[model samples]
Every structure is written in C-alpha cells, then in structure tokens.
Target: MSDLRATFERDGFLVIPDFASSEACEELRDAALRLVEETDLESLGSTFDAGGQRHGHDPWFLGSGGEVRAFLEPERDGDRLRVNKLGHALHDRVPLFDRFSRDPRLAALVAELGLAAPLLLQSMVIFKHPRVGGAVPAHQDATYLSTDPSTVLGLWFALEDATVDNGCLELLPGGHRLGLRSRYRRDGDRTWTDTLSDEPWPSDGWRAIEARTGTLVAFHGLLPHRSRANRSSRPRCAYTLHVIDGEAEYEDDNWLQRPPTMPLRGFV
Candidate 1:
C-alpha cells in the first residue's frame, strides 16, 4: 500500500489490474445498457460534444448534476439512437451504482491513497459507442469540479476492454504537478472558462492506458488526460467516480451543483 501511494504521488495516476471481478464489471455494463433502453430517446434532444467550444450550460446538461439523464452523441447513424453517456448522479440515484460506489474496497482504497474525509462528488457512465463516439479534449478534472486546495480524485473503471483502437485513456505522466490550467464555472445563467495557465501539453511522453475489464485507473484532479474517438466496432464502456476531500471548500460557482436536498456522500 505504501508503494502504491508513492507511485501515485510520483505519477499523479495509478492503474490497478483486476480491481473488480469480471462478473461485477459485466453487471455494470448490463445496467448501463438497460439505462439506454429505458431512456426516452424521443424526448432527449441534447447532443453532448465534449470537445466542443461551448461550455455546456444547457439546462439539460447543467441540471443533470443531481439527476440521472442520458445525453446523445453529436453524430449518429441513420435512425440509430447513439447515447454518448449517462451521467452526473448514477451513484446517488441508481441502487446498483450506489452499491458499487460505496463499496468497502473503494473506501479503503481512498484511505490508502491518503484522502481523509473523502466525499463522492459525481459519477458517470461513459459509452464510447462505435463509429460516432466523440473525442474528449485534454483537460484537468479540477477545471470543472473545483475545490479549495484542489483535492479531486477520479476513479475510472473499465467495464469492457479498453484498447488503443477503442478510445482508451491517454495521459501525460506527472502532469498534475504542472498545476491547474483553467477553471470552468457558472455565473448565474452563463458558464465560462477562466484560464489559469497557457502552458501546452508536451508533444511527446503521452501514455495510452489500455486496460482490461474490471481494471481501475485512479488519477489526480490536475492530471491531463483525454481519449480519442472510437473508430472500431467495439464499444468502450467505463464507469467513473469523482471524489474530493470533504475538508476542502467546494466552490459554489462550479458548473456541477447538487440541489440542497441532495448532499454529497462518502463511501461508508
């Protein structure tokens, strides 16, 4: 555990193989597929483009922080309903997701990583569907989920095999030490990004993380990471949970805000 902590501190990210059983991973994938089938595609008009210039301020997107909702991919096959992701509150709203998020193993992992009083802030199911899955722009998690002293940690679990050909995560090693590059915040009805640094990502040294099913990759808030578009026939499904130190001040202006009725939770 000490070695793992040291490695995480040094690289700003750590990958644990077979963190969850294959059966558990399949269960989560089945749940995500069920969510897509249960959703009313006719009523959902929002198309989520992660790399789009616009900071997502649409009511459907902004309001999803406290609810479970599905967003569509920007491009779609003829008559096919392509959902990009189901996000923001699955852990709080869905029973299976809730159990997975609050698992004892995860709680102990957070403790081992030295996050005292960790609060689970947000969760998402990313469906990098074949062909139309959009590329995610390189960005820091702290830019959107900001907290004082910046202690956000991201846990990404691969429900399906994540390969280089299927949009696996690509990260810049030790990039978290470079500090936050920007802040994404909302001002009343408007949302914008405040640039903190103009530093560019290095042209080299990027590492592609091809993970097997049930593998868990944990990364720092300031770590720079992104995934390419999935051009293969396979789908890259992942469940992600973001946690922050409860001792830190969560900024009110952060784009993702839960209503007073729903408070942040921790793995118990």
Candidate 2:
C-alpha cells in the first residue's frame, strides 16, 4: 500500500492488479448487465451541441436516470440510445451498486492516503462496447467535480480485462498539476459551451493503463485522461467511483448535483 500510495502521488495514477476476487467481479458484471436490460434509455432527455450533434447527459440530468446506459454510435451519431456509460451516481439508487461503492478495501486505501474523511461523491459503469464504441474526448475529472481546493480521487475497478485494443484508460502523468483545463456542464436547455484553460494536455508521455479482471486503479481528480473506441471482439466493462474530501468546499454548480436533503456517505 505504501508503494501504491507513492506511485499515485508521483504519477497522478496507480493500477493495482488482482485486487478483487473473481467472484466479486463476476457479481458486479452480472448486476450491470441486469441494469442494462431493466433500463429505458430514452426517458433521459438529449440536447444538441453547437455542432448540432445530439448529446445526452449522464443519468443525473434526468432524476430517474442511471439504471442503465448506452453510448451514441459515432458512425450513426443521432438520437440513438446506444449503450456505453452507466452513471454519475448509482449507489443512491441501486442496492447492488450501493454495496459495491462501500467496498472495505477502497475505504482502507483512502485512509492510507491520508485523505480527509472520504465521502462517496459519484459512481459509474463505463463500457467499451466492441466495434461501434466511441472515443471519449480527453478531459479532467475536476471539470465536472468542482471542489474549492479540488481534493478528489477516482477509483476504477476493472470487471473485465481492459486491453489497449479495447479502449483502456490512457493518461498523462502529473496532469493534475495542470490545475483543471476545462469545465463542461449543462447551463440551460441547449447548453454545450465548455470553458477551457491555457494549459493543454501534453502531446507526449501518454500511456495505457490496462488492467485484468478484478483489478483496481487510482487517479488524481484533475488528471487529464481519455480512452479510445473498442474495436475488439468483446466489450470491456469497468466500475468507477469518485470520492471528495469531506472537509472541502464543493461548489454548487457541479455537473453532478446532489439533492438538498442528501448527505455524503463516509467511507473511512
């Protein structure tokens, strides 16, 4: 754990291989598939971007969203409900997901890192569906999660092997020091204008952080990263959870908004 902590602090990310049990990974994978079958993607509203492309917000945009999700097929990028990513927060809505979010191992890791009382801020399931999967534009997590000092962490658990061919996460080392380059979120009915920073992603030092099934990866909140389209035969599934320092001041206009009556859950 000390080595992992050092690597994360130095590089802005760390991948811990074979951290979870195969049984646990399979259970979460099964739960995700069930969610896909049970959800109605169209119920979530869609808005057009400046380029006239229909962009669908995460399940948080629609109060009833997050049960399941899909990505728009870039080839036929229209109003399609093609599945890709699962959510901004599922623990608040799903029993199985809620359990997954509170994994003791993750809690221990946060404590070891010396983070202030870790709070569950967001949870998501991202899919790199084969062939028609789309590329995620390079971005920073803090773009959506706006904390005053911006102390946040991201945990990505690989439910399946994520290979370079299947759109594994690629990151730029120490990118968090760039201090958040953009802010993309909903402003109104047709808001797609995103703010940018002078600091741009380095054109080099990018490497894929592939993981086998049951592995976990940790990254800094402001790290700049993205993934490619999965052209491989099988799809890759990953479970992602985001945490914030409980003592930090979280901005009110974050893209993922919590209800006024809701409280952040303690992890460690």
RMSD of 2: 3.6
lDDT of 1 by residue, 1-268 (tens): 5998999999999999999889999998899899999999878888887886453768888898899889998788677879989999999999999999999988988888888999999999999998887888899999999999899999999999999999999999999898889998897667888998898877788899999999999999999999999999999999999999999999999989899999998886
- Candidate 2, residues 147-175, lDDT tens digits: the string is 88887888888898998999888889987
Model 2 lowest lDDT segment of ten: 44-53
- Per-candidate clashes come to 0, 6
Candidate lDDT values, in order = 0.91, 0.72
**Best model per TM-score:** 1
Off by over 4 Å in 1: 53-55
Task: List CA RMSD, all candidates.
Answer: 1.2, 3.6
Clashing residue pairs in candidate 1 (N, C-alpha, C atoms within 3 angstroms): none
